[model samples]
Target chain A: MSSVNDIQNEIIEEFNILGDDKESTIFYIMELGGKLPDFPENERIDSNIIKGCQSKVWLTAKDDNDQIEFLADSNTDITKGLISLLIRVLSGKKPKEILDADLFFIDKIGMGNIIGSQRSNGLAAMIKQMKLYALAYQTKQNA
Target chain B: MSLNVDKIRDQFPVLHQEVNGRPLVYFDNAATTQKPQSVIDAISGYYKLDNSNIHRGAHTLADRATRYFEDTRAAVKEFINAREDSEIIFTKGTTESINLVASTYGRKFLTKGDEVLISAMEHHSNIVPWQMLCEEKEAVLKIIPVNDQGEIIYDEFEKLLSEKTKILSVIHVSNALGTINPVREMIQAAKKWGAKVFLDGAQSTSHLTIDVQELDCDFLAFSAHKLYGPTGLGILYGKREVLESMPPYQGGGEMIKEVSFEKTTYNDIPFKFEAGTPNIADVIAFKTALDFIREIGKSNIKNHEDELLRYASSSWSEIKGFIPVGIAKDKISVISFNIREMHPFDVGVMLDATGIAVRTGHHCTQPLMQRFGLEGTVRASFSVYNTKSEIDQMTEAVSKIAKIKNK
Candidate 1:
């Protein structure tokens, strides 16, 4: 299990290599998409689908013994990598932890500065979908 | 063409610049045309000489401002050959103008099971607004289908028009495809069903001669930026009776005659649609741009641009794997195409490296892209100032890019 500090280190290192420029960051994300883990057929469903995306994206979160985990895929290669980066920041936490987490980590990841308007918009849509999932999980747990 | 190409080119200061170690070849004219020196001077003169809020004030500056502001309305009325200046409403570009109608006019007149017809080749601005209106009104949104060449199938459109068709909002010229729509025929057919027709004139206003009375469209919308005027200003021309019938789009100053606590009486025709502080300087500057067009004459400009288009189409056709996207029998100067083995973005970037600027995207017509099964196209749209020499340069750049990508 990776600690929060460990994940933070991974993010920092990854961002350092990608640089802070928007064009470079998009290229980096596109490269990252080439290395993303594939999701199984059963994992691709409605809870994962993101609206307002030009590309089709599916993200699934698994709650295992109070820890949250996620896997995502997109038909668009660059968007797939973007989903992967999001999963890295958002996955592997409890529902409460995910709900409490600051998604502004995207700014720290340099995604806000590094992508084109459309790609950045797609990222925003993905982040919204992830946050919604966390909120739904919290509500279900509370209920 | 009798127009001096060199002299005309010199008038636009922005054109005399170097980008990436080469002279900038601006082909993004369909998206927005470059403003000439005269238009720029007119804009500056407005701010420096006559900077004041229009219509209401009695002060010296206000009187001058009001005169200049209202002068633009008169210019627009004459430009489109509308019956009166009262019919011309100034809004924030084509998108806002379209939305105003969908929200106000559509809400008032349309109901469940009614139809609003649009073409498949419309910009997302035209498509989304009506779709939203359809959702709210419980009306069905019908599409006038386009052929593979991006021309609307007139037979299909004729058959689609029915008594239930309340409105037919269509583009006069498709920004993405460059297809010059048969708007006169469309207006006649749609009118037979007692449907109001709105023409999206964003593309056509710059390229083609527009006479709203001649076309007989109930409403027409166009942007200043696309016509080589200032941005953030557009005209919405509606027939007096239709505009009077629709309620005011927003509640604000200038749009209302008297705002009491109990009830508010709206202002007449155009003012009822224009709310808040209008883009005064830009609106006034638009007169100079229109004057520039009038001086050149629309027919001469079209002929010059058509010559450039003919050169580009014939030259670019020679390149291997180069397929032009929109090939309607009647198209304006917009040439949208894709090269095999090259992504539209890659093609755009390559062209930029050679100082050629072309819009490489869905051109804000994603539904049109979806219809063609393409993500985007490399769009090289022309204007009055664009020369055949520039088209030759573009063709050369595209050919080189295609070869490099193919290799």
Candidate 2:
């Protein structure tokens, strides 16, 4: 599997090429969401739900061979696409790497210009949830 | 006489600015209107010249402040055509006005098994207060169901109205759907059963000509912000008898006549409800908003907005996959719609990129959203200052967004 930085670099390169066209960037993000694998229906419960999002997002994570894998789904296409970006860059990485990653690509890609302020808050929320999952896994492994 | 659109637009300084790269197209009037320079200046003027605690102050500034504060009440009294100035009570906004009624008038009058009737199109402010009161008093809350077009079913409302229905509180114009409810007819019907009627005029005050005597609604509540006034100020109009009979909402400085450990007496009708220090500056400046509306005339403003609504409704209908949510025949200048398979939030984001501000969501009416089988809608509501060209810009952007699906 690719490292988190490698995936982030790839994303940054793709967004940079997309350039100042906000619409195309949004469309591309939504397309990425459409490509996300179907999250298990049984795992989509209240416990996995992310709070403070305008749209409902369910996220579940698992620890496999010391790597963290995250699965997420959102009712809205743009929000779903947003979470897919997180999953793609952070999934299949060590919990500590996932926690420590700077996520510089978000700013480099001008994600704020596309998502607007409120959705940026939702993006922040998704990041927080992912970090929480990483912390949970790190605790379980230590115990 | 037709309103001078350019001259009217010039009054609002906020409209002259740019958002992002384009000129701001503010279509979120239903949420809150941008204040005119006159209203803004009035607010600043109050602080500059006559800033003091109102009601009882020995200083000269106090006398000036108290007169200005009371002048707004008289202006509001004339604006709504209330019989007496004492009937108008100033609260924070529409939410506080409704909460005050539910707490004071509702709690004392309503009892177990009594019913409180509300329309499905009510804002959460109107709904939640009654729900809390119902739970507390063991009263049943009945809703007047709205049809697909977002108009209330008058037959259903008639059937629901009975002696058990103690209160019939309905929205005069729905903030979400823009449906102009038949409150006059509904109020007349409710009075037949000896039920008290309240009208939530948050959306209506700016759009329609309100003569409280003509409608005969026992209580009318609205916010100043929606009428191109300052925020944090609202008017709750109750009939003199009703205001006199109800208990004071809160026990505080202004609401009391005599206070002691042994016994305490409440003040007069309006003072009894307005507790503590009110939103003094905002309330005083709200008179300028009323003056602005009166100078334009409500009918002329309505005519201009109606033209915009008609033009927009017809123009937007041509767009592909454009599904209009609330298509009531009689409505204010508000349109709630969705493109098939497109989320309202995404539409809002795209619109913002074009410097167009539209409210996208349930708009604090979740039950109404549920009734329409929608999570939310993209709502574009207009005011007097909005232009046809702005509507053109919005529709063109929306058309392009809708086309994204086919591509």
Candidate 3:
């Protein structure tokens, strides 16, 4: 029931003290990616595909009771983990709720400093894509 | 290996430093070569002394800056053996230069059903712009497929050339694969069909000797960074006639002769394409880089790089379970390889720990990586400053990593 800001705050808290070392950061991200909720098969296609990212992310959303539930999977180990992190904040929320999630919370989470420029850009792209999904879902729900 | 490796290394201030607790081994020359102190000084000196905008400035500083900026253009014209200084246009980099032609020339000249012929081994920069252009113009993008050895299939390329072919843009050297394309032959063939050719000289400009007159390409594009100049600067060499004919890419100050609320005339050839405040410092410093290359002589640099490549090939190839990519007959100093059962990133990390800077992953040629059925490759590209001893260290480190990872 929490807004996107709350979810972002939770993500920031979760990312606290993820180490400065590249290997450590990678390991932490991998662990985070592994913990993401499983996505439904039916909802996965077209819009979920990310073009430039090194990771293969499959995103799916379902209306879980009254809330929006997101299931995201990635083939690349670290990237899959990134998908999991996205799911934590973005999943099990309403379309408007997810859309309202504060992206700037990444900096508070210490993930901003940890991730490379490319990965950060990828994360931003991921957030954007997910928001678009949420917007689409909201439109569909209204329809 | 005629280059005084020690002296050359000393010239590059960045190369002398330590990274990750080890002496830096810069093999990421393909991405961007480390600039020498002379180049750095030149850039700083320009800003320090003559920091005014060029062409229009009546002041002493303005006149000096303008003279130096145009001098680089003159130097670039000689560097590529272009017809005139006006033929060389300053761009942000090779990517921008290619996009300028693809957008402007493609828009003005090419129509529906006109074909844009490109090689299969092209970088994404070369591929995507044309793809965008083709989509916009309803034109066709026909690729000249590579052979097993990663060289272009000459027969296939020859067959594809037709009256419909409006443009043939190809990489003079494949960045990912290190395959030196037979652009001369391809350009000659394309010329028969009256097709204009744009050579992506991003990789070749650093290693191979380029003579636009000799290659006879309509346009040639390369970045200064790859040639030991500062980053954020590139040269776009186009035939004066062809450049004059094409519409300007950007509309702004410097690129225009007259600016009004009504119809405005464009500036002459080079400036017509170069819009806004140019990367003056980097462009001026690039003259030194060009001069540096000329002093070394292209053949000598090629010989040294070739030797290093040969040594690495012999040494690294012998490592158990080490798989080398891009075994083209004609190549510059790029060596892309993967180890058995080990991720390229892991290998890169291990190499980086030893202070060896190598590029990992698809190298921005994801489509090519998909074509090769590879996730990524650990790339060790060489320059004049790199040594056999450095390669030996790289070999030892790679062998140990492969053994540990595979086991």
Candidate 4:
């Protein structure tokens, strides 16, 4: 399995190839979102809701054999794509690896340029929520 | 007479700029209009020349400032054709104006079992304050239903009206859908049942000719920013008898007559509601915006904006998977629609990339969205300065985005 940094670096390299073409980058991201696994309807409740988003987003996580797996969904295509990118980088990783991982690729690939200002705050909220889930799992593992 | 659209566009300096490497096409007029150069100049000119606190300062600048500030009230009174200048009260904006009525008029008039009737299409500002008032007074809050065509069902409203209905507050034109309500007819009907009528004219004042006497509405509230005027300024016009009856909304520096700690007499009608130092500079500058609109003539501006709305709506209907949200027969220059299976926010962002500014989300009218079974709609609203060419550009970009589904 690739390390978190290795996966982030791969994404950075992929997005870097797209260059300054905003439309193509947006379409590419949306296509990735379309490929995300179906999130369970039951889990899309208020408790799993991620705030600070213009569109509704739900995120859930569980520890599978000490590897954290995340499932997320958004009402908006771009937001869905954003979560899929995050999940692709951090899912199936150990709780400690997920918690310690840096998401510098977001700025490196200029994701802010594509997501716009308002949704950039939403992207930060998604990252914060995921890190919180990882921290919760890490605490449970110690016990 | 045909309007000179290019000349009008030249007066607004912000229209000349580019947003994202493309010339900006601002269709978010319902959210807030781009100020004309004259209005901007007037704002700065106030600070440069007549900068002083209004009313009480016994100085030369103060007198000039007071005259300019009160001049706006006179302009607004004439703009709306109110009965008297004293009937007009200045608040922070439409939201504050509505809150003042809800807290003061509602507190005094509404009692248990009294009903406050609002339409299905009210913005949150109109809905929330009444909800808060109803909750406090133990009064009943009722809604008049909106049809699929995005119009109020008159029969439903008639059925809902009763002696128990003490107040009827409705939007003159919907901010989200651009549905122009029959406020005059509704106000007349509500008055038959002895209910006070208030029109939320935040969206209408810029597009329509307003006559308070003709409508006979008990109160009317509107914001300046929506009318190409400066922000932080709004006008609330009330009937003389009604204004004199309601208790003071806020008590502070200006709103008091004589304060002896134990017995503090309140000031007269307009000054009684204007609690503290108002947005003096913005209020003074607002007269320039009103004058600008008058110079163009409201009817001429309306004709130009109506033409744009018709052109855009007809062109947009040709796109595949296009779903127009509000298809009211009578509307201002707003078009709210959604491309099938595309989130309104995504469409808005895609439009923004092409320097087309449209508004997305519930537009502060979540209940209206629920009525349409939608989370939100992409709204493109026009102003006097907007041209048909800009609408064509927007429609072309929207058409391209809609084709993304086929890919």
Docking class of 3: incorrect
- Model 3 is docked with a DockQ of 0.11
Instruction: Determine which window of 10 residues in candidate 4 chain B has minimal summed lDDT.
Output: B398-407
Q: For residues A42-136, what per-residue lDDT tens digits would candidate 3 score against the true structure?
A: 65676776666655667666677657776777655567666777777778878887787776766765565444566677777788878887898
Task: List clashing residue pairs in candidate 4.
Answer: none
lDDT of 1: 0.85
Query: Which residue runs does candidate 3 get wrong by more than 4 Å?
Result: A1-53, A56-117, A120-143
TM-score of chain B of each: 0.98, 0.99, 0.98, 0.99
Which stretches in model 1 have alpha-carbon errors above 4 Å?
Answer: A1-143
TM-scores of chain A in all candidate models = 0.78, 0.96, 0.77, 0.97
Measured on C-alpha atoms, candidate 2 has an lDDT of 0.92
Across A72-113, the per-residue lDDT of candidate 1 in tens digits comes to 887655576677777776787777666666665566775544
The local distance difference test score of each candidate is 0.85, 0.92, 0.84, 0.93
Judged by DockQ, which candidate is best? 4
List the DockQ of the predictions in order: 0.08, 0.49, 0.11, 0.60
lDDT measured at residue B117 in model 1 versus the true structure, 0 to 100: 96
Give residue A139's error in model 1 in angstroms. 25
- On a 0 to 100 scale, what is the lDDT of residue B186 in model 4? 97
Q: Looking at model 3, what is the TM-score of chain A?
A: 0.77
**Estimated TM-score for each candidate:** 0.79, 0.96, 0.80, 0.97
